[model samples]
Target: PDTTVVVGPGGSFEVPLNPPLTNGETVTVIVTDPAGNSSTPVTVEAPDTTAPAPATDVQVAPDGSSVTGNAEPGATVGVDTDGDGQPDTTVVVGPGGNFEVPLNPPLTNGETVTVIVTDPAGNSSTPVTAEAPDFPDAPQVNASNGSVLSGTAEAGVTIVITDGNGNPIGQTSADANGSWSFTPGSQLPDGTVVNVVARDAAGNSSPATSITVDGVAPNAPVVEPSNGSELSGTAEPGSSVTLTDGNGNPIGQTTADANGNWSFTPSTPLPDGTVVNVVARDAAGNSSPPASVTVDAVAPATPTVDPSNGTTLSGTAEPGATVTLTDGNGNPIGQVTADGSGNWTFTPSTPLPNGTVVNATATDPSGNASSPASVTVDAVAPATPVVNPSNGTTLSGTAEPGATVTLTDGNGNPIGQVTADGSGNWSFTPTTPLPNGTVVNATATDASGNTSAGSSVTVD
Candidate 1:
């Protein structure tokens, strides 16, 4: 992606490169025409004339665990791990003095390593010998806390403790039995992470151990089910479930079952329409998130009956809710559901009588029932009838028995009226013989005002 311009016919160009090229390197360049046809590529090599500086200051690591040395940068350093002095494996030396090289099979205290350096062109330097370091394996750590790091290690080895940042905290030697502990000068900060290592008398260090301080809180309890007073839910096993009312007063407590299922019966009965909170605590006094369950013992509002009384009782209630109709004595008369529209209806086996007292109640989806609503049934009229004595100037009828009869002239002008006996019969004769061809009609009304058809009679 570099820009260059060349002239036509006898064109030639030069490509520029940045600094930092190594000796004994080669680069090839190719020229292409505007149509992408390529010319022969030209090759060039940079000559290597200088050898690396001699290796120096070769020495053993503090613990003699590895070979460390200084050499010319970019030189390969060989470590004779088996001490035969001819290099076994060679490592590229980084840009520093006394860099460490790990021994595959770590050298024991009595073992030695012979190290040599070589330049890129294969020039070798004089050899140096280093003794191996002795160290125990990393310690097994557990239950370490604010002040103490207790664990198992090689018998009589010392344990060193440090914060996660590798800063020293404390150190202690193991007992003859291989148990060791290090107590920091001060308690470990809550939630701080710490690392530990084991060391032997030979000045070697083991791998570091890492641990995080534990103060984790438990998970919150889950409350479920329709009734708040009788709650069912999950919590940590063996934890205690403590319940409290909205006022923050203790209501009761119970232990969670082995499966983490729990139930608590409040010392005081939880009333409807109250909010309550529950907390779970482990034996260690670690509390779980607060679980809340609101007491909703309240049913629904008393259902009202439209039209007050009828074969079918209807009213408004919770949608998809169960509604019950009861007599004054609290006996269930009928049951029905309030539709999704929040409307409900119930019809009893026997029609309710006039002035009868009844009760209406509504239930919520949660099974809460409303207080009974008092309803007084209104009266119902009796059935209608037919008349008799069609042509005698006399009025007679078989209608509702014990009904009252009102007679009128053909034009509907009222002439007189009478009450029917229990046999359902009624007659009304003119006090004087009727004038020839006069017409009369009569209607019968029950005690409840249910009326019968009219009877018309002509004079004899």
Candidate 2:
């Protein structure tokens, strides 16, 4: 009989009939069938073992506790249990898979950090998260100091303090015991108003106290001219003299001395016409006021005569000449009468004498002497002028040559005439030359209006 088996192309084929094939078994069968005769048949045996298919669907727990599902037996499991973005801890899965990833320092509040679990199969898990707490509120602040000028504070006449916003801080009066203070809860920002105030507990402030802080002193009182008033001697020079004040003061002092002198120097200057208590104090301090006395500053007047003495006897005084005397102030003091020959004699009532430098005045009933006259009385006479040509009996003098000579008196009166020849000698024939026994007076006058004294000649 013929038999045939079908096999895939390019594929290995083994066949066994009926009983299972064993190792080393061999069999043959005829080939072609259907219309033709077959050729050969073949036999094969199966081998024993083969590897199993790779495992699938590996996974890890969502809480990162452990890994599960099918995987290779000795596979590694890892977890970033701290969620610190790294796989820090590891576990080896024995034939049954399990692991414990301790919560890495337990998660913080409000944090969303990631946790990863990686398997030996190279797979990772999702991240884990936690949250944290919020921050606290800010605190309040305040500041203060004791006083403006004194202990624990600055010393000044004026003080100003300000607040954090540069606003001035308010103030309150110090206690009755004269103490000042301030207290605050918290520190102030830089340049905040502290406390600046002053307290004068004793209340002893001077009117000038306002000047003390600036180191200036008070002004002093002023004194006037500082010298005393002047005094005079004579009432004719006037008595009521006024002393003027150089500065402005109220009270003044004035006084007059025993010699009719008045003056004063005041401690402070006073205004004009300021009434004063004038006390005339003696060396012993005995004082008087409103004393009455005559004041005089002028010299005594010179004595005078209507017809001056030694005045060439012009007319005889029938009623004996009278002379008047007066004082320097032009006030008449007294008069004196002259002797019988019209001689005048006058003695001043005042003892002051010649060269005494006084004003002399006289008034006649005709008012001709109304204007006063100044007189320096000198009773002494002037020295006589000397006579030049000697007293002469006859002049035997020469004349111009060949000229006629004329005899004349010393006053140029012609007494006689004579003629002379060329010799210039002339002799008078004396019709009446200078009468004998006559005493003739001779005066020579020069052309300069000077007259020499007369010379006497006795003719014999």
Off by over 4 Å in 1: 1-79, 82-86, 89-155, 164-169, 174-187, 219-460
* Local error of candidate 2 at residue 160 (angstroms): 99
Residue-level lDDT of model 1, residues 1-460, one tens digit each, is: 3434464566656566565346767777667778988778777776664655655666666555567778877788888887576787777988664456877666775577777778877777767777655557889887443656688999988788877788888888889999987667776766778788888887778878788754455699987633454766789898889877788987778889999998766555567766778898875456788988777676677777765434656778767767877778887788888888988877677777777777877777545788777676654543444556455456566666777788777777776788878887777775665566767776776654445667677755
In candidate 2, what are the lDDT values of residues 328-415, reduced to their tens digit?
6666655544356544344453344433333334322211122333444333322222222222335344444443444445565655
The TM-scores of all predictions, comma-separated, are: 0.31, 0.16
Error of 2 at 25 (Å): 99
Regions more than 4 Å wrong, model 2: 1-324, 327-333, 336-360, 363-369, 390-460
Report lDDT (Cα) of residue 143, candidate 1: 47
Give me the displacement of residue 215 in model 1, in angstroms: 3.7
In candidate 2, where is summed lDDT lowest over 10 consecutive residues?
206-215
Q: Global CA lDDT of candidate 2, please?
A: 0.35
Q: Which candidate wins on TM-score?
A: 1
TM-score of 1: 0.31
lDDT of each: 0.72, 0.35
